[model samples]
Structure formats: C-alpha cells, structure tokens
Target: MSEHDFHVHGPHDHELEHAAQHEPKGFAGQLAVITAILATVGAFFSYMGGATQANAALLKNEAAIRKTEASNQWNYYQSKGNKQNMAELAAELVSSEEQRTKYRDKVARYDKEKADIKLKAEALEAASAQADEESAHQMHLHHRWAQATTALQVAIALAAIALLTRRRWMEWGTLAMGGVGVVLGGMAWLQL
Candidate 1:
C-alpha cells in the first residue's frame, strides 16, 4: 500500500479511541468528563501563556528601540550644546560687531536646537519607560497563565491516577486541583 493510503496511531491513540467509543459510566464517566474539561482549560491556559509571553517580548523590544532613540536624541542634544559653546566663545573673540552678531545668532540657533533635542530625548525616554512597564505587566500575566496551566496539568494527571487506582481520595484531589487551576485562570484573565 502507498504511504498516503495508510493510517497511523500513537501508543495511546487506539486506547483513547476505544475509551471514546465505550464512554465509561458512573464514577469513571464523571472522571472522564472532568479530565476532558481540565484538558480544555489547560490548553486555553497554555495558549494564553504563550500569547502573553510573545506580547512581553514584543513590548520589551519596543522599549529597547525607544531607549536607543532616546539615547541618540540625547547625543544630538549634547552635540548641539557643544556647538553653542563654541559659538559663544567665537562671539567673545570676534572684534568686529558684525562677526560677533553672526556668532551670537549661531549660538542662539544652537541653543534652540538643543532645547528641541532635549525635549525629544525626554519624550522618548518616557515612552521607553512606559513600554517597559507594559512588558513587565505582560510577563506577570504570562506567569499567571503558566501557573494555571501547570495546575490543570496536575489535575489531569490526578484524574488519570484516580481512574486507574479507583481511589476516592485521588478523585477529590483531582477536583481540588481543577478548582485551583480554574481559579488561577480566572485571576489571569482578570490580570490580578
């Protein structure tokens, strides 16, 4: 048979399909339903964690870019200041009034340019700071999502264990963990 004509299953796939078809009753059925729900919740949490992590990374990159821009503006401001100082010194040394006035005009122009550059640099710095704050918040949310996902995974594992061991305590443990996972997920959603 051609490769396209064949089908393959992972180690647990056959058993999973069988379980789906059989649909266990009573306690096992309840455990199965809870496990399915937990799995779904875990998937959502995992997705949110990844999305938040990506947002954090993107915001951090934006912050870095803004910081670089601010640094460049500061450098420009410094250069303008240096030019103004040179013009001031030239104005003092020039004997002719016309030459002195020209140098003074240059000094004034440089001063104005420096002021504009400083303002731009300060604004960029503020923008960078804001981006950094946003990135940190996203990272915090990502961590919360990760925690929720972990708890749900643990709950799913407990459900499997309870199903195999037929232990009442394990079932309770699974429910407790599931509740914790859901609560964490809610907290993450609320950004608390």
Candidate 2:
C-alpha cells in the first residue's frame, strides 16, 4: 500500500490514537447513566397518576356545586308568599325541581365517573409507586443510580459536577440514585 494509505490505516494514526487515548468512564459512569434514565422514567409515571386523580376530584366537585345551585333555585321559588306569585312560583318551583332532579342525576353520573377515574388514578399511582420502589432498589444495587436520580434533578447536575471534577466514583453514585427521582418526576409531568 502507498505510504498515505498505510498511515491512514495505522494504529498510530492521529484519529485512532485520539480515540484510543480517551479516558475510561468505567463501571461508575455506566451506572450513573443508567440510574439517571430510570429515575426520569419513574418521575413521569407518578406525575401522570397524580394529574388523573386531580381531574377526577375536580369533576366530582363540579357535580356537587351544580347540584347545590339547583337546590338553591328550587328553595328560592318556594319561599315567595303572594297567592298569585305563589301560584306562578309554584310552577317555577316544579320546573326548578325537574332541573334539580336532572342535576341530581347528573351528580349521580358524575359520582360514578369520578369513582371510575379515582380507581384508575389509584391504579396508576400504585404503578408509579411500584416503579419508584424498583428504581430505588436499583439505586441500592448501585450507589451511583441513587445519587443521580433525585426528585429535583439537582442530583443530575451534581453528577455532572462530579464528572467535571474527574470524580468518577461520586458521579456514578449520584447517577444510580437519580433513577427513581427521574421516574417520579416523569410521572408527575405526564399527569400534568
């Protein structure tokens, strides 16, 4: 082969040497990366579950409010005392009663809907919790995951700091811990 071609393929070539000379991230670096990923996942699911619960609660409250308003309207119509007004008011009361009944029915429907939503939210929450637990367990398996997966993501930045400082051990440890935090955060965000 030509000298130029030989140089290109040689192990001592600049590109090859540069790539080979790169510092090893080692076990710690791998652990940190894995932990961070897991934590992020956990956070996402938790947020989703919480948001579902909140929406269900809001719907339930709205149903109650509507029912209350309907009752108030019915009572107001019944309270007027003039005979002519009373007669008209009585009719209005009946109409209001119908509306109240409708509202009550709506409330009942909402109640059922809310119950279903609540159940779904609860199930999601349980899943989120289980994910968190698993992430935490992973962190325990490797300290790096636990430290990097904080709920606040402060740990992730901290992991970067450790990396920058050439503190491979700390970096990995932080990353391992962060997996659960990430998962929980992700869950919350999804719910929102």
Candidate 3:
C-alpha cells in the first residue's frame, strides 16, 4: 500500500490543518476535519470490536468442550462407584472364602479408579471455569465497542446535518456525540 493511505489527506494532513487554521472558520472546513477524525476513530473501534468478538467465540467453544469432558469424567466416576458397590455386595453374598477375597480386591480396585476419575473431572471443571471467565471478559469488551460504534455513527450523521445547515450548535452536538464514542472506546480499552 502507498504511504498516502496512512493519512486522511496523504502527507499533507498536518499542512492542510495548519493552512485551514489561517483560513476563515466555515462549514466546509469544519465538516472535513470532524468527518475525517470521526472516520478514523470509527474504523479503529470496528476492527477492535471484530477481534474481541472472535476471541470471545473461541473461548466459549473451549469452555464448552471442557465442560463436556468434565461431564464424561463424572459419569465414569459414577460407573466406578456402582462397580465398587456391586463388588462389596458380592463379597457379602459369596460363600467361598476365595471368591469373597476376589470380590474384596475388585472393590478396592474400583475405589482407586474412582479417586483418579474424580481428580480428572475436577481439573476439567476448573479449566472450563477459567475459559468461561475469559470469554465473559471478552464479551464485555465487545459490548463497549458496540456502544462506541453506535455513538460514532450518530456523530457522523449529526456532522452531515451540521454541514448542510452550517449551524454551529449542530457542530457542537456532533462533537459531543464523538466525545461519547471516544469515552466508550477508552472504557473498552480499560476493560474494567
């Protein structure tokens, strides 16, 4: 891309503004300046909002996968518990001493297996919670960005009216709207 793309009016943006400072205050100049600044800020907010929303979606998906894994582990742990219970019952019912000893051994094995499964399930749940928290934070960022975008859009619309009517109050109203957008954009950056 050309260097001109970086500035609203190529390399002459500063020069143009300096020249405009010496010229008479008029609707045309004011409209040009305000519209340019608003467009630049609006573009930045749009890009940031898109990136944040994408990150949120990815985190949400990760959380869902972790939750599913946690659920599967819990189910496996329950199955192990059932096996342990059945083994205990078998030990009580069997008449032969050798068979009773085997059932008691099986019960011990299931108990050990259940302990491991429970740990795995708990770890997965923790991971899911972390992912969910991050996803929620990203969603909050997106909300601020959305509000900023709306304000910027309104400012742009007001700027158009100010240009058409050459009304100073309309220009001030447009500036106020842009201020709101900037504040919201800053809030999104702070993420607090």
Candidate 4:
C-alpha cells in the first residue's frame, strides 16, 4: 500500500481516533470535579462573613476606650480639693463637666455606631452560616467526585498497562479515563 493509503487505513485511523476521543468517562472523575468547585465557593463566603464580625468588635472596643478616658479626666479634677483654690477649682470643675458632657455625647454616638455594626455583623454571620450549610452539601458532592476521580485514575493506569502488554481493551479504557480526567480537572478549576 502507498504511504498515504497506509495512513488512511491504519489501525489507529480517523474513525477509531474519533470513537476513542468520544468514549464516556467512569464515575469517579465526575465527583472530584464537583467537590473542588463547591469548596472554592464556600471559602469565599466564609471570608466575607468573618470580616464583618471583626469590624463590629473593633467599633465596640473604640467606644469603651473613649468612655474610660472621659471618666479618668473627671476623676482627676475632683481629686484636687476646694479650699483657697476654690475659684480655680470651680473653673476646673466647669471645664471638667463640659469635657464630660462632650465625651458623654460622643459615647452615645459611639453606642449607636456599635449597634449598627453589630446588626451588620449579625446579617453577615447569617449569610456565612447559609454558605457553610451549602458547603456541607458540597462536601458530600466532593467525596463522590473524589471517588470517581480515583477510580478513573486507576482505570487509566490499568489501560496503560494493558496497552504495554498489547491488549486492545486496555487501550480503549485508558483513552476513556484520560478524557474523564481532563474534564474533571477543568471543572475543578472553574469552581475556583
């Protein structure tokens, strides 16, 4: 036969090549791809929820610090008695009282801010929890995916062994497994 004829009629010709490429994958590879995708989504929602909770805690701490500073200033003025220094002490008292009033107002504003933060944090936390629940379902999917992936890998290896030993069936199985692996890996990456 001519070289071109040999090429066209070869055992590994176009029809066989197309058939090998289009073969169905085993169960294991499909499961692994699904799980990896779910994990990526879960991690994202968890991070956002944690950030909101942290911000609320910080606002609460700031408000407490301001209240403490105002109280300390008032105490310092009171500690200095009202004898011959009564006028100066009186002026000091007025100044201290004004400072206390300003701080009190600030404290109120801070309290409102803190409350708002808490509300936001709670909402975020709820959202995070929902994400976590969804992830749990995904975990099961991951297990199935992993199992399928492992099985396909094993099948591919077996197919390689079969081909090396000149077994036709093994070659076909290997080709099938390879396709499965590629699809699963692609799916896993897309999940991210």
lDDT of each: 0.94, 0.50, 0.92, 0.49
Q: Could you report the Cα RMSD, in angstroms, for every candidate shown?
A: 9.2, 13.9, 9.9, 13.5
Which 10 consecutive residues of model 1 have the lowest summed lDDT?
18-27
Instruction: Residues 68-132, candidate 2: write the lDDT tens digits.
Output: 55455434333322333434444455657776565555545544554554555455445545554
* Native-structure RMSD, model 4: 13.5
- Displacement of the residue 118 alpha carbon in candidate 3, Å: 0.5
Separately for all candidates shown, the number of backbone clashes (residues 3 or more apart, or on different chains) is 0, 44, 0, 6
Best by TM-score: 1
Report the C-alpha lDDT of model 4 over 57-107, residue by residue, as the tens digit.
554454455445545543433433222144444444665777656655555
The candidate with the higher TM-score, 3 or 4, is 3
Measured with C-alpha atoms, the lDDT of residue 125 in candidate 1 is 99
* Reference-based TM-score, model 2: 0.36
Q: Could you tell me how far off, in angstroms, the CA of residue 151 lies in candidate 3 after the best superposition?
A: 0.7
- Residues 1-192 of candidate 3 have per-residue lDDT tens digits of 787676446667887787568544876777789989998999999999999999999999999999999999999999999999999999999999999999999999999999999999999999999999999999999989989988999999999998766688889999999999999999999995
lDDT accuracy of residue 25 in candidate 4: 52
Please list all clashing residue pairs in model 1, or write none if there are none. Answer: none
**Candidate 4, overall lDDT?**
0.49
lDDT score at residue 116, model 2, on the 0-100 scale: 55
Q: Per-residue lDDT for 50-73 in model 1, tens only?
A: 999999999999999999999999
After superposing candidate 2, which stretches have Cα over 4 Å from the reference? 1-22, 25-36, 39-43, 46-50, 53-57, 60-64, 70-152, 179-192
TM-score to true structure, per model: 0.87, 0.36, 0.84, 0.32
Clashing pairs in 4: 28-148, 28-149, 29-148, 29-149, 31-145, 32-145
